[model samples]
Target: MSDAQSLWHLADGRALTLAGAAEARRLAVSRGRVWLTLSGTTDRPAEDCWLEAGEAVALAPGQTAVLEGWPAAEFELLVPPCSAAPGRGGLLGRRLFGG
Candidate 1:
């Protein structure tokens, strides 16, 4: 398998929102430095830690991570449930239905 399938890129000053138990995994970088802020929960970001370009960090579930600064910076992000994994379909298939 090619690693290209596992790569994701985010533009500067852009934020991504995740719902439910979803998790975001990827490699990211920011020009000078980037800040990640977690809102809607009791979790807070580490003090004075900026995400530099060419760094990898795994965003914890149930939190929103915001990327700031750096234009043209790129990163790789891998969402949960493994897109190429067998037997696992879309979110609808994983939901419960009443009889």
Candidate 2:
């Protein structure tokens, strides 16, 4: 994330629902451990993966997934850069537009 503080924060037994797992490029567990479960799609059944703190994983496009903080966790997600980010518009936007 551009701003590290914006990282996803979760409590014990809490979960973060991700809608565009397909568009997601990477997931990083910054604190504690988490269970990442990919939802079933047309061609495949659901799959689950685990990540401890400091671990990062690549994600396949076009999938849905649920991230859970089994016992408390914090994580960050990196998606493909957008044409225009909400604030600085990302590196590309800033370079092209000249903020």
Candidate 3:
């Protein structure tokens, strides 16, 4: 895992929407469960599903996803290293480099 892979926590019953990403993303649940709605495009139909801990979904660049925490959840939005911003350092980097 890369240092840029940060974790997100959501309380049960809470929901969040992710959209307009510059690049594709992989949403992975680390703990608990989540309900997700993936917006449809001309070529693909919209999708609704449940993701348990250790499951993941691949989201396109322009796709939209609505995620609701199921009895609380923790997840990570994984972006490709090539897609990450250059010269940007994250928490792990800051801790390791002491910068």
Candidate 4:
């Protein structure tokens, strides 16, 4: 996993921008639903998939997705080469649950 990172929490009716040529590897949603808008492409609705109470999506290298209409949604951003490993639980499990 690379050390690069970006994180954001968006609210309803709000939109976050992803600069052109920017590359994001993973996005973990911690809260509400969000819409994704790719650069040079039309904005589209993206369902908020729940992994845990505070975990959502994880992308691979060169994968990019914008967020919109994510009211009160917490998201942890991970950049290329720094992908989340499989089989390992989430922060809550490792922290409170003691995975």
Candidate maximizing lDDT: 3
> What global local distance difference test value does model 3 have?
0.85
Worst 10 residues of 1 by lDDT: 1-10
What lDDT would each prediction earn against the true structure? 0.48, 0.73, 0.85, 0.53
Model 4, 1-99: lDDT tens digits are 233556677877887765443443556666676666543334333333324335555443344456774455667766543233433445643564344
User: Per-candidate TM vs. native?
Assistant: 0.46, 0.66, 0.80, 0.46
Per-candidate RMSD, Å? 7.4, 4.2, 5.2, 9.6
Given candidate 1, what's the lDDT at residue 6? Answer: 41
Model 3 per-residue lDDT tens digits across residues 1-99: 563587999898999998858787899999999999999867789999999999999888888999998899999988866566755656665565554
lDDT of 2 at 60: 62
Identify the runs in model 3 with alpha carbons over 4 angstroms from their true place: 87-99
Q: What is the lDDT of residue 42 in candidate 3?
A: 72
Clashing pairs in 1: 8-76, 29-53
Model 2, 2-65: lDDT tens digits are 4322488889988888775434467789999999998776767888999999998766666766
C-alpha lDDT (0 to 100) for residue 68 of candidate 2: 86
Ranking by lDDT: 3, 2, 4, 1
Error of 1 at 58 (Å): 1.5
